[model samples]
Target: MPQLNCIAPKPEHGSTSDPVEGGLSLTKMSSESQNKAVLAFPVQPKPLQLPLYPITLKFEEVVYKVKSEQEGFCCGGTWGTKEKTILNGITGVVCPGELLAMLGPSGSGKTTLLCALGGRLSGKLSGKITYNGQPFSGSVKRRTGFVAQDDILYPHLTVTEALFFTALLRLPNSLSRNEKLQHVEQVITELGLTRCRNSMIGGPLVRGISGGEKKRVSIAQEMLINPCLLLLDEPTSGLDSTTAQRILTTIKRLASGGRTIITTIHQPSSRLYHMFDKVVLLSEGSPIYNGPASTALDYFSSIGFSTSMIVNPADHLLDLANGISPDFKHPTEQSENMELEQKSLRENLKSSYEKNISARLKAELYNSEINNYSHTKDASIRSNRKAEQWCTSWWHQFRVLLQRGLRERRYEAFNKLRIFQVISVAVLGGLLWWHTPTSHIEDRIALLFFFSVFWGFYPLYNAVFTFPQERTMLIKERTSGMYRLSSYFLARTFGDLPLELALPTAFVFIIYWMGGLKADPVTFILSLLIVLYTVLVAQSLGLAIGAILMDIKQATTLASVTTLVFLIAGGYYVQQIPPFIVWLKYLSYSYYCYKLLLGVQYSEDDYYECSKGVLCRVADFPAVKSMGLNHLWIDVCIMALMLVGYRLVAYMALHRVQLR
Candidate 1:
């Protein structure tokens, strides 16, 4: 057998004083020297830090597997679609220090392979995949790493923050900050990703970093734990040839250095083709070829055809040999070879999986030493890692996420518009304060109406426009697993709690101190709370609206319509709502917020003359002492509920909504 050497000594250069060096000269070598020169099949690289007794990575075969997906919406109230078979029976193993490529064109069930292998796909799979001899499951995934095609990065955060945050989440706490820093630097250096290491990542037009750099960051994130088996989907998409080649080189090196890397590549260069130790080809949800890349040619040649230079071998396989062949002649709209090829590949993958890993992987088998159960058969299964319980947790994630959010506050650009308007309202309220004492009924009534209507826009503006912008980044971060949705919501609430009071508190403060809405300091404080409640109601609704309706134009339109409806229904600016539409007030955040604001803002002997003869008597809208409309507390509770429900829904829905 011919030996293949990937390791090469540095070629000697002729000693020269010139700035540009001359080309090297070769000398013929004896057979002994030739043998020393020959390389291994797949070049094995030196480990980063070898353990005293080699820390081993073992892989094993998956036998007969069947997985089904219900033919219906992931969520529904309608008749479900028929269950569709995704992975019929996939059997394959990826062992350490080997570069394994899952080659397939569109709809070839390639992604399903990774998803199933990663344990993210929920379905009944009649197969067994033992990791170091242990069966695969959700618990098995903590020690593994997976990267999807899209780069899920927070645009607001700089590159260092993003990568470091991911590192903290994946790395063992024992790894010190300096060690983590060095580890990140080493991976980035290996991938030639030093450029743009401190830029913001994504948005419609933020102009922060390149696509390739972002991809490198995404790859760097996965390398944090140095998992034994790393999975990537369409690793080369969206990259230029040079960058893609560099990426492939990195993956190849990682595999050669004793990690098992399984990735999908749509099209690969011949250089990249030579790097793969093994390849699995899939088409139309079936595998056609599963074997060595070098021998892939001979496999096709054995069938009386040769790879044409003009066509890419991957495209060739996807086109014909894989059975989605353009030359395919369907028998009554069905393919015979497709089934034959699929079954053949499944069997081959199983055989190959068993062949490559079974010998070295017995340590992973039902060994009582590492097994948990008292029973022997149950010995192969692993308990979930304690880290995963927290690693996969959205709480720890949320705190880190909230920290990032607070860090993000530097750029929040709180509107001067809100600030100016609040101050303006305060001064006017103060003028009213001086004259409001012992006022006519109409004067007092107008004051109460003004209190209710003026505060409505605050929440309206908070929930409607500004939130949609923040949602874009939050959605992306959520998809990337940056933090928990609930944590973000809670943090956002607290983070803004201080900021939320800025306008309303300021407006109420100036008026209460200067205009004198109430003599009691306690009443003044309660009024300030009412104002903050309005802001919370607005901000929460704004966030919820951002999630529910994505398009800003639509949200903007709806926000305008929403404010008007809340005003009329709350029974302040206009006549009372129809009895049938009274419940509309329940959903209207402003209605409750207004009740709270009015209770704190007035005294009943208060009557006001509006342009209209009179409004809700100033006396009627009094504080808790006489106001009866403890509706303010109801508003506070409703706002709190909106905050929680909106965030929860956003968390779940964030993954579903596409960022681009």
Candidate 2:
């Protein structure tokens, strides 16, 4: 058995060091020398006071099966369901202080294997995975860090702010604020992200950090907790060669510090390939080769798929694993034999590796290591340590999440376009119904109804995008055990309240006086409060739609239809709806808001001259009584309850749908 050793550039006396072009120099050695070198340098960093227990992840006979439904057009798009095997009895071991790269073609279960190892997949999985001889549990999951390929981050937050907030919610409650900040700073330095620490992590619309920097930020975020096992899926998928190499270099350094790293990479450069300590080549969920990366080429050569000096060993191995034979310009002496060899290459490689002596010896060594550590007393201590939750207290989680939510909403909520839209609507409505006379009861009622419709529509429309945009981030964070769904939901709902109220309050203040609806101070105050609560209710509805649908277009369309229904059911429109469907008015915030506004203005004492010649001064038009809106307080209370109800439903939907 061979031990993994970190390969660093050995300084040459005459050679000039060029950081960019002068790549890290490597020296080949025998197994004995490698073992000696491994023992010379400390695997785990001693400076960091945090525990870095060596983790050995062993998976045996792992199998994952998923039942998927395929829609067929024969029976009016009926679903034809079947069980699919994703991982087929795969076996491997990821030792401590090593960098393992899972390589395979598209749909080869690289991501699936990584997910199964990290307990992220949510399907039927059968396997025995042990961390230092113990079964995988919540404690192991807490101590492990998984970074998905997509960088799920808040684009509005600066790098420092993002890391700081993550630390606040993720670190234990025993650590002081300054201690958490120190941990964040250490991670920032370790990942070389200090330069862009203050820059915002922008997205497609807003330019911020570069893609490579964003990936590093993602790694830094996970590194905050200092987990022993770090798993990443396609960490360098979209990065350029240079950037990918740099990221891999950082990963190698981390591995040298005793963290077990398992990353799935696609089409890595030769330089990046050499950085890995081991490689697991999978073709259609079956391992073709799993052993020391340095010896992989020799293994393949011994199995009769020799590679030329010009070809990268990793690429050649992948080609063979994918059942792609090398192009031969000239025909061989026996073309039939050559074709047979090409067809059987993948199976031959898999069979050869399974029967190889080195693989068996490695397995024996792993078994011995597992047995050696299984009976140790450290297991209980590690279990007790794992018993400590990764998150802070419930209230602390709320506070930290609230701060993050408020900061994000403040940056996202008050965009120029939204502010401009609100002001435009206010000014347009004010001009259209300018200086309304109390005697023109129809015009006054129309103006109030328009206000209700505007407030309700704008808030709901904006709130529709909130949950959709944050859905990925929320799921990622929640799966990491950084915070609970309730904390996040409460924080988001309450954090947006001040800003949600601010705009509507200002809009009502400007439009009320301009429209000249009953100028009493009490009427003005009541109208302001009603509009504020109406916007809140609309926002709540938007959140619910967003959470339930998980698609921006779907949520927006549903919200629009819902708002249109409320608008139609509002008291001003079709005041005499049929008795069978009249109950729908109770569901419309617009209806309650319009009824309250009408009640505030048209009291029993107020009288207006009828336009028709048959009747004169019409007193107490009976609009409020006819609609059965006698209790203003009840309308307000119902609106408040609706707000709570929508938010509660949204929370439940989010909790149910988020990744477990």
Index of the highest-lDDT prediction: 2
Instruction: Tell me the deviation in Å of residue 580 in model 2.
Output: 2.6
lDDT of 2 by residue, 419-505 (tens): 887788888888888998766677877888887898888889888988888888887888788887888888888888877888888
**How well does each candidate superpose onto the true structure, as a TM-score?**
0.68, 0.87
What CA RMSD would candidate 2 show? 9.5
Q: Which candidate is the best by TM-score?
A: 2
The local distance difference test score of each candidate is 0.57, 0.77
Q: Encode model 1's per-residue lDDT on 100-174: one tens digit a residue.
A: 788876766778777666655554555665554445533345446677887766676787777777765554444
Candidate 2 accuracy as lDDT: 0.77
Residue 445, model 1, lDDT: 39
Clashing pairs in 2: none
